[model samples]
Target: MKFYNRETELEALSKMRDLSFKEHSQMTVLTGRRRIGKTSLILESCKGTDTVYLFVNRGNEAALCKSFAETIVREFDIFVPEETSFARLFTFLMELGERKKYNLIIDEFQEFFYINKVVYSQIQDIWDRYRKKTNVNLIISGSVYTLMNRIFKEYKEPLYGRADSLMKLSPFSTNVIKDILKDYKSDYSNDDLLALYTFTGGVPKYIELFMNQGATDIETMVDFMIRSESPFLSEGNILLIQEFGRKYGNYFSILTAIANGKNTIPEIEEALGDTSVTGHLKRLEEDYELIKKKRPIFAKEGTQTVRYEISDMFLRFWFRYFIKYNDLIESQNLPLLADIIKKDYPTYSGLTLEMYFRQKMMESHEFRNIGSWWEGKKSTEQNEIDIVGIYADDKRALVGEVKRQRKNFKPELFNAKVEAIRKKALFKYEIETKCLTLDDM
Candidate 1:
């Protein structure tokens, strides 16, 4: 967990910081979901430099401002005796930036909405008036994805288009995770790696917690989760409740349906007692970015060949286990819940293996398009190809079948899937069929 990956983000942040210090004020906005290490990235960018870091906590606005004023004085050696208003303190900092350069990082910036709804407009006004004269490297970050995007990207919002650079931090890549697993457990198996990826999804905070506690395998990971005071138990609820707010019932139901394998619109609709879920699904995909809409490769735009999958590995596992077995958690039946998870981990982790390989192929960057190909209108899912990669050169394609072990891969049958897809989708190219297994980790 020693600050893996994010080299691109660090470079941009450094450039912006240097530009702000040399020229004038430059605003950098960072947005990502909870525990994506926004604060860590910001602080890392400010290493060996003078910085005033402020966290926007939910409370009285004046009290928050007073606390920030003290940090500003202590960090920047300024004479802010007591500024009770954030607007006044912010203006003071901007004015001070005109004389001296420093980094100013504001974490949980979206919390300003809860503290003082008018803070956004106030900052916008001050920023517009002082940006040309100030030399502060202002970095503001928020964990609430929807709110943060709206605050910065919406044309009508007060802080709209104010950022000199906007960066969204994603989870660590498959390579980073592998390096981390090697560091923690050198003898880790493919299943062990998959378990870590399946549960943590390369989220930094989760990786730190599990690896630091020596829970690098499936059983140990689940054991750590079900223990008292474990954040994994209610993490899914805590994460989405803040985003979905009062209208979370339907969203949670839709996500649960997806996690439980009711992947199609019709299936999810049937699971929800035939309630219309188009709007909710749209928001989940486009706004929340929780679930993904998938179609068979080479499928037409309006084709009736769509499926839905939860995009987050951890959330998918959480809904499948934590939400589905909430009765056990609520009743304090931790042992039984852990037992059920152990019983189901193999079947559950296999589906995650498919996703893992897809990501692995994506990370290769050799393919122009990558997806699975399955026949439409096939009620029996017998004719499906696991991984399909259309190379950027347009002369070759990769058709892969994923299995836990290479021994389970039937070459003849996989070749049959290759032929079917060739006649349907990749007839013009040479096909290379591969068996993507855990060893590929």
Candidate 2:
């Protein structure tokens, strides 16, 4: 695939490449979910440069040693003994870097924990010994969240503060989807793009799969994406398993419960099994990077009215449609799913639009900060503000709700919601109010 926009990251990589020749080793740690094109980004940036890519696996120490030796010998055409260990192989690369400038990439780096628990310390030793004498740019990439952070970000880790650059590769933006549609000569309308964005959230791999058939209508998309035997059908299960292992079953239950409209802690626990969900929720938020705890809009720091929501657009969509109807989908009844989708889609999608707004708020420069708002009452008296953006410099804030159906924008609904927001806003910063929509903004 010809690479799309990563101009900022590319520039950052180039700067790191230039800096690699300085006294210290120039290292970058790239982290993201699986198949968000982290490797693609690395490949594109390393083009025409002397670069070596090594993919680490979760095998035993001896197997990993052999793989490293083979990778070094095969990629560099260097003669080496069969029984060489990774320590020796990496040490040799460090010496080579003393003579020539090169880029070294270790993909799926988190597997090193399983392969050799001491590998990070060993690398740190080599780096400290030879960093000033070498001109190598090292990039460590991983899909596992906790392991990667422990190796590089944790204060006590051997490689702590070692990275000169850290890039967390995220899903592509909605604009990228529009660009893809335009490039493919698909004349999809704005609403179609919004629906696609709601479902895929700019994940390049998922978008490309659904875009293959040259149809962009939401109804057609639901048919193609949720149908039996579709590659995307059970993708959520695979994705979560890859990230969280067997514990993914619990996480899946939590996400599915949220998708079914269970938001509070007690509600989620009841829906999943019991209060044991507390541990699973913590891991989902802290380790897997899949969910977030949401407090009411204007709540103070440490305010207690909190709810949980899935943080990824594609996962939310998957749980809402595919996982919720797992039985029907598995029994080869896609038309039945299509029917359920037809009935529930508007409601489900209206929820997704709120997420869409969050993505836009993250990327937009118009707002200084953005978040959601709700009342202090956890279950009872809960009024929601879908999108809340603050413009402190302007003494103004933008409060808006997102709906899938096309209808006239109403100010009365805004007034009712604003009162609830005002009650919560008292504890935090304040600003004037404005309403917005997809077109209005």
Give candidates' CA RMSD values in order: 1.1, 2.9
> Model 1, range 198-308, lDDT digits (tens) per residue?
998989999999999999899999999999689999899879998999999999999999999999999999999999999999999999899888889888878888999
The model with the greatest TM-score is 1
Query: Tens digit of lDDT per residue, candidate 2, span 306-420?
Result: 7888888888878887887888876888898888887876677667667777777777777776888776555342376777887646456777766554364566776777777
Reference-based TM-score, model 1: 0.98
TM-score for all models, in order of appearance: 0.98, 0.89
| Deviation of model 2 at 248, angstroms | 3.2
**Top candidate when judged by lDDT against the true structure:** 1
C-alpha displacement of 110 in model 2, angstroms?
0.9
lDDT (Cα, 0-100) at 324 in candidate 1: 91
